[model samples]
Target: MAKIAYILLCHKDPEAVIEQAERLTATGDCMAIHFDGRASASAFRKIRTALTDNPNVTFAKRRVKCGWGEWSLVRATLNTLQAAVEDFPRATHFYMLSGDCMAIKTADYARSFLDQQDKDFIESFDFFDSNWIKTGMKEDRLIYRHFFNERTQKRRFYAAYGAQKRLGLTRKIPADLQVQIGSQWWCLRRRTVEAILDMTRKRRDVMRFFASTWIPDETFFQTLVRHLIREEEIECRTLTFLMFSDYGMPVVFHNDHYDLLLSQDFLFARKISPDAKSLKTRLGRLYAAHDVTFQISNEGRNLFQFLSERGRTGQRFAPRFWETESSLGRERELLIVASKKWHVAKRLLAAIGAQTDIPTIEYLFDEENTPLPDLGGIQRTLEKRTRHRRALMRMLFDYYETDRLVVCMDPAALDLMHDFFSDRSHTRLLRIDCDFSDSYLIGHARRVGLAGERAPQATLEQLLPTIRNDIANEVDQIRGAGFSHHWAVQERASEEENARAISNFLDLSHETALDIVRAPHLFAD
Candidate 1:
C-alpha cells in the first residue's frame, strides 16, 4: 500500500529515463515526469512509449524549456511535483531527481524506511552564512530582476562576464523569510513537496522574485521548505552522489568509481553512460539503503567481503575513497575542525588538495553528522561523532605534532581551544566568520537557550553585534594566549580570493597559488 511519487526533470536521454522510471515504478512508485520543452518531439514520444504500459506514470502538461541557470528549470520541477501530488494522493514520499540518476536501493527498503521516519529528507545549509556568497551565491540572484528567454539554449550565456551589465535587484529580500540554499536533488515527504507547491501559489511574489533569477531551481524549494518545516524535522541531506572533475564538470560513471559507489550507501548515483548499461543490468539490484543486498557480481563478492570485514556500519561508515597526505611524503600539519559550515571548508580543502606542499591534513567533520563533502574526486572521511566539541578539538591539537597546525572551526570550538594552543609553535587558526539571520538562529536560541558554539549568554537584542565581536574577541584571545601564527578571512570574499589568501599564508608558491582560487559550484549536474 506504500507508494513513493517520483518527480523527474530531464532534458536528455528519454530511453534512460524510461529504464530507471520502470525500475522505480516496479517498487510501488507513482511517477511524474517533465521533459524539457526544448527537447525534440521524438524524444517525448519515446518517453511516452516507454511508460505506456504503466498507468502510474503521469507527464506534466506545463512542460518548461529548461535551461541551465534559468528559472524555467524551477518551473519544470514544480509542475512535475504538482502533477505527482495531484495524481497520487496515497504516496507519502516524493523524490526529486534528474534523468541521469539510477536507483541504487530497492523499492521495498525505501518504502519501509520512509514509513518508519518522521523527518523530511532534504539537504540545506545555513543561508545566512555570508561565507557561502563566494561559493556561487551571486549578488544578482537576490537583488536583480531576470526576464525569461533572456538568451537562447543553443549558446551559453556568460552572466558572470556581464556582471556589470546584469540587472540589479529591484527590492530588498523579504524580512520574514530566511534564505537557505543546498543541493536541488532530494527526497522529501509528500507533505513537504505539497507545501512547496502551495507556497508557490500563495507566495507568488517570492516565486516571481526567483523566476528571472539565475538557477532558482537550486534555492527555490530549499528556501520554501525550510519555511514550512522545522529545521530539525528536515533531514537536510540527499541520497544521490554526483562526481565532479577537477574543473567541476560531471562525468559519466566509469569502472574507476566502482569501489567509491559500493562503499557509500547513497540510493542513487548519476551521469551513468550507455556503455555502463551492461554493468548496471548485471549487478544493479544488490545495493540497498538500510542493509546489504545478497545479489552481486563475481568481481564484487570479494570486494564486498573486504568492506564487511572492516566493520562497515551502513551508509555512515562507508569506506573512504580519497588520497590522504600521508600517501605522499607530506607531514601532518593542517587540521580543519568544521561544523555545519562544512561546505565552506570543502571549498578551502579543494584548493589545498591541489597544492604540492599539501600537508597530511584532516577535514575532521563528524559534529552534526551531516553528509560528507564530495570534493569532485575520490572522497574519504573518518566518521567519529563527538559529544563534546570543545574537548575533541583540544585532544586533536595535541594529538598531532606537526610543524604548522591549521584550524578552521566554529566560534565555540575556537573559544575552548584559545588557551590550549596559545603558545604552540607553527599553530595557525583560520577563523570562519559568519552572520546568521534573526529568525532561525535568534528565535531558535530563545526556545532552546542558545547552547551550541555562539555566546549563549547574550540575549537576541545584543546578539546581532555581539556575535561578530565574539569572533574577534576569540581570535584576539587565542593570539594572546600563545598561537604562533594566525589569520582571519572573510567568507563573503570571492572563493578564489579566499583560497588565494589561505594559499599564500600556508606559504604556497605564487605561480600556482591562483589555482587555489577556484570557481564556485554552478547548479548541480
Candidate 2:
C-alpha cells in the first residue's frame, strides 16, 4: 500500500482550497498546506479551522509572504514540504500542488499508478540547451543576481539587471551542480524527497546561490533532484496537464473545458478558475467515482490544431460553417487575381468581373494606387498599411459587405499574396505570366532609378531570369500547400483567348466569356 502526502502552496480562495484539501485526504492520506503570509488573516483562519478536524492535515509553521517570480515562493514550498515530512511518516510519495489545482482522476487510481512506478515524475531538462524559457534572460538568469521582484517592482528589477550587465558582475554555480529547469509542480518518491531535504540541510552555499536567482522556484528543486538521482530514475515530464499562452501565462480551465479536462490522461490539472462551479462539481464527482474508466478524446487535439493553423495564418474572420454553394455563402469567397504586369492583372480582374456579379477593384494593395484613405504622407501611409495589412483587408471586406469581391494585385506584393495563399478555404489566386518586354523593363528601371555601371536595359536583362525563377518557385510552394491556383501565360494569347481562359479558370459561363471579348477597353493598356 503506497500512501501519498500532498503539499499544497495556496495563496487565495480559502473555500476552494478547503474543498480540494478535503477531497485529496478523503482516504487515509496526509496533507501539508502553506497559506501565503500575505493573504488576509481571515482567509487563513477559515482554512485552518475547516481542516482542523482532520487529523491527517497540517500547516507549515514558517509561512512566507510569497511574491511572483521571487525567492519567497521557494521558501514557502520548502516550509510546506518540511511540514508534510514531519507529520506523515508513513507516506511513501510526495506530490506538490497549488491552490488552483484539482484531481481529475480518483485518488485510488493515482495511488495505484504511483505504486506501480519507481520513477520520479518531473519535468527536468538542461537549462542552457532547452528553449523552454521563451522570454527574458536565459543563461543570464543563472549567471546574474536578481534581487528585485520582477512582477511588482519591474522598473527596479530592470535597472538592477542593466547595472549588473554594465558592471559585468556575475555569479557562478557550484562545480558539483549542473543547473536544470522545469515546472514547479512535481511528484517525487519518498526517497527522492528525503534526499532533497537532506541536501538543503547540508548545502547552504547552493541554497544561498539560488536565493538570488530569478524564479528559483522553477529551478531550485528541479536542479537539486537531478544532482541526487540518476538519469534513468527520473521522468522528464509532469503528470499535471498544464498549458501556457503565447504571452507565457497559464491558460485557466472553465466550464466550457469540462470535456477537455476529463479526456486528458493526466491525474491533475492546475490554474482552474474559481468561478467555474459547474466544472468543479463534475470533476469532483469523477474523482469520487470508483469504477469510471477514462477515455482520451480528440477535442483537445482538434483545439491545438485549430490554434496551430491560426498561428500560421492570421486569425480567421469568416465562420467556417458559412461554407456553402448558395449565393449568400459564396459571398465569403475572396479572389486575388495577380500578375507581374499591372495592366495584365487589371485586364484579368475586368474579365472576371464581367463574368460574375462580384465587385472588382484595381490595384487595391498597391502602395501607390490603393483606394484606402491616405495617412498624412506616402511613407507614413505605407508603414501603416503594411503594419495592419490583415486588419485593412478585413475592413475592406466589411466596407464592401461581401468577401466575394475580386481585387487586382501586383506580384510585387508578395506578403499579401502569401496570406491569401495560406488560407485555402475562402480565398483563391490566379497568376498571369505576361511578357516582360525590354521596352517596359526600360521604362520600369528609369522610374525606379536603376543607377549602376550598366545601362537600365542591361541591368533589367541581367535580373529577369532570377525574377522569373523566384516567381515560379513561389507558385510551386502555393500549389504544394493545396491552394486553389491557376497559372496562365498570356504573352502570346489573343484578347479573346485570354478572356476565355480567365472565364474558364473562374468557373464562369461561356456566354460571359463572349461578353468579356466584346468589351475591348478591358484589353487596352
Candidate 3:
C-alpha cells in the first residue's frame, strides 16, 4: 500500500540510466518515470527497449524540452509529480530524483523512515542565495547592461537572455533572498507537496520573479519551502550519504550502503571513458562511483555479505561499506574489531586471506551477546598467555618490523585498550571509530604512556638538548601565525612527557584536537 515515485531526466547514458531504473523497480514499492531529452528520439528508443518489460517504469508521453540554467526542468518535475499524485492518490510520499541517483535505502526502510519523520526531508541548500545560482544571472544581467564595460564569456549571458525572453522581468533584483540550492533529489510527504503547490498559486508574484532567474530550480521550491517552513522550522537532512565527503572520505555510513540502489542518485559521476580495453568485463567498473577505490572482484564478496546481513536485520542496521587503509597497500598489520554477527567481517577476512605475506587478524567482538565461534576463545586465550603473546608479538614484530595496528571498535573498547597500552612499548595503535562523535579515541591514545626499552619520559633531558632550541623556534612560529593549535617535532625520548604536557595544556585551554594539530612539533616527528 506504500508508494514512492522517481522522476529521472535523461540527457545521455541511456543504458546506465535504465539499468538503474530497473533495479529500483525490482523493489516493488515504487514506480519510475523517465523524461528523455525530447530532441533525442534515438536515446528514448534505446531506453524504451531496455525498460519495456519493467511494468513499474513508464516513459512520459509528452516531451519536455529543458534549457540549460532554466526553470523548464523544474516545471517538468512539478508537472510529473502533480500527475503522479492524482494517479496514485493512496501514495503518501514522493521523491524527485535524477537519472544519476540510485537508492541507498530499500523501499520498505525508506518508506518507514519517511513515515516516521512525517515531514519533508528536502535538504536546506541555502538555495535562494547560492552563489552558483546567483552568479549566472547577475553576471549575465550586468553584461547585458554594460555594467563593467568588459565582454566576458557568453554562456551565462545566453542563459539569462533566454530566461528574460521567456519570462519578462521589468523590476530590480532582490537581495537578502535565500533559496535552497541543492540537488532536485528530495523526499516529500504528500501534504508537503500539496502545500508547496498551493503556496505557489498564492505567491504568483514570487514565482514570476524566480522564473526570470537563470537557475529557477534553486529559486522556486527552495524559496517556497523556506517560506512555508519558516514558522514550523522544518528541517531535512539528505537521504543519501553524500555528506560523508565533508570528512575527506569517499565512503558513506557503514550500515546503510544500498549498493545497486545507490546508483540512481547522481552526486556527480563520469561515464566510463572510451579508453578502457573491453566493455563486457570493464563497463561495470567504469560505471562505479569515482570516489570508490575498490575494484569489482574485491567488492563483490563484501557487497554480497552486506546485503545478506541487511536482509537478516530487515534492513534496520543498514551500514555503508568502507575500505581499510590496507585496500591500497599503504599500511600493514590491519586489525578489525566488529560485531560477531556483522556480515561484512566475512568478506573482510576473505580480503585479508588474499594477501600474500601480510598477517591480518579480525577480532569479532560479541556486542549483542552473540557467542563467537571457537576462534574467539582461542584468540582471547592466546592474548592472556605470556608464551603465546610473546611468540606472536615477536613474529609480528619480525614480519612488520614496526607494528602498524588498525583497531575497529566502539568507544568503550577503545578506552579500555588505550588504557592497557598506556604503559606498554613496541606497539603503535590507531582506532577507526568513525561512527561516533568526538575525537576521544585520539585523545585517549595521546594520554596513554608508550612502552619499550627506551623510556621517552626517562630520557627527555638527554634528547631535549638536541631539539629544545628547534622546539622554541617552532613554538614561536606557531604562536606568531595566530595558530590556536600547533605542532612541534621533538626527539622520541620526550614522547610521554610531551603527550602529557600537551594534553594538560589542551584540557586547560578547552581547544579541540584539530586546534592542536598545528602543534605537532610538541611531539617527536
On TM-score, the leading prediction is 2
Across 1-525, the per-residue lDDT of candidate 2 in tens digits comes to 788889898876788788888888887788899998967788999999999999889999988987667788898888888888888989998888987788887777887888888989888888888887866578888889998765344446788999999999988888899899999889998889989989989999998989999989889989988999998989898878877543233555778777787788688898576557898888887766787777876366467457646754757443221122211122256677777567766665555554444556677556455544222232136565555555445444433433355777766676676665555326666666655555665555555565344565566788666555666676555445554555453556775676666565555656776676555554344
Give the better candidate number (2 or 3) by lDDT.
Answer: 2
Instruction: Kindly list the per-residue Cα lDDT of model 1 for residues 1-525, writing each as its tens digit.
Output: 356788888766676678767777765678899988856788999999878889789989788766556788888887888888888888888887876677665666566667777777776776667443434437656666555332221111334335435543255676767777777888888777877787778887787778866667667788888888987888877767665433233434544555556555566777565446555773365432345552323343354446545643554244222212111012224444332244556555545543432322334433333322333221233333222332333233222211244444554555434433442222445655544455545554554455444555545656656654654675566446554445545556655665655565666655565565553541111
TM-score of 3: 0.41
Off by over 4 Å in 1: 128-137, 148-170, 283-525
Task: Between candidates 1 and 3, name the one with more favorable lDDT.
Answer: 1
Task: Kindly report which residue stretches of model 2 are placed more than 4 angstroms away from their true locations once superposed.
Answer: 297-302, 307-525
Weakest lDDT window of 10 consecutive positions for candidate 1: 322-331
State which candidate has the highest lDDT.
2
Identify the superior model by lDDT, candidate 1 or candidate 2.
2
Residue 510 shift from truth in candidate 3, angstroms: 71
Candidate-wise lDDT, in order: 0.58, 0.71, 0.43
For candidate 2, report its TM-score: 0.59
Q: Candidates sorted by TM-score, descending order? A: 2, 1, 3
Backbone N/Cα/C clashes per model: 8, 0, 42
